[model samples]
Target: MDEMAHKYAHILVAVDGSDGAEVALNKAIESVKHSQGATLDILRVLDLNSLEYGGAGIALDGERIYKIEQANEDYMLKLKERLLKDNEIEHDALRVHLRFGNPKIVILDFQKEYQNDLIIVGSTGKNFIERLVVGSVASYIIRNANCDVLMARTAVNKSK
Candidate 1:
């Protein structure tokens, strides 16, 4: 492989506050480290459609929903800070994008808008098990994304 050709100029890493997702983010950061011109775009998608109104005899309030959204944003912000604080990578080139929608759609839309060179995501174990189930976002993105996708497995890729 040509070291220069494999350089990722623009990368998008999707995280959902999962340990597996953090591993993927670390992999994306590693790629940016190799390509000095590369830029890292970290995204956290908030799925409002899945928000329950009344479930299991429980009620949710508007204030609670707002708080949830705020918490998600704050989490992403903290992640951005941690990535930037690392001296090995250029902090000025890192960006964080927070969106509310289906994660699959949001990711694909951002890929198209930014023309991202690569998309990195954490692979769920459901793909290997026939009886087990997995969330739809990872499946949808893996099947639909036009650009190259890297599905990081927890054992192989550890968070930095």
Candidate 2:
């Protein structure tokens, strides 16, 4: 690899269990494979704001929150297991983080705290109006993150 080519030493990939996120995770794995001594962090943020609005004005009770958290944990664990089985990377080289807060803020904060060299995120392929209403975490990270951001597009989208 050319010295001029950017080599990420610490990669942070945000995953939400979406197809796009799966693509981003694969991309991160590949990047880490090429970069010596690189570590990969997979993060899943349970957006509190989304949950609040998701209930249509009803606040989530404690039991509901616990259930959601548990489900998120299970999902992350499954993802980790799949990655380990399918990739050559060691178990210790990969870390999974499940956090609560706004997705954008949590991701940016994590990158800053870890001083990650690169951030990988998946594009939801939301239309203009939907993006305007729900907000695009990838777009926000690209505009604000201090490190390099990779917005992994779905394979279907790439053909277009």
Best by lDDT: 2
Looking at candidate 1, what is the lDDT of residue 148? Answer: 84
How do the predictions measure up, each by TM-score? 0.80, 0.88
Candidate with the greatest TM-score versus the true structure: 2
Error of 1 at 136 (Å): 3.6
**How many angstroms is residue 105 displaced in model 2 relative to the true structure, after the best TM-score fit?**
0.7
Per-residue alpha-carbon lDDT of model 2 for 67-102, expressed as tens digits?
A: 999999998898899988988887888889999999
lDDT of 1 by residue, 67-100 (tens): 9888888887887888778747777778898888
TM-score of 1: 0.80
Off by over 4 Å in 1: 1-6, 52-61, 125-135, 156-160
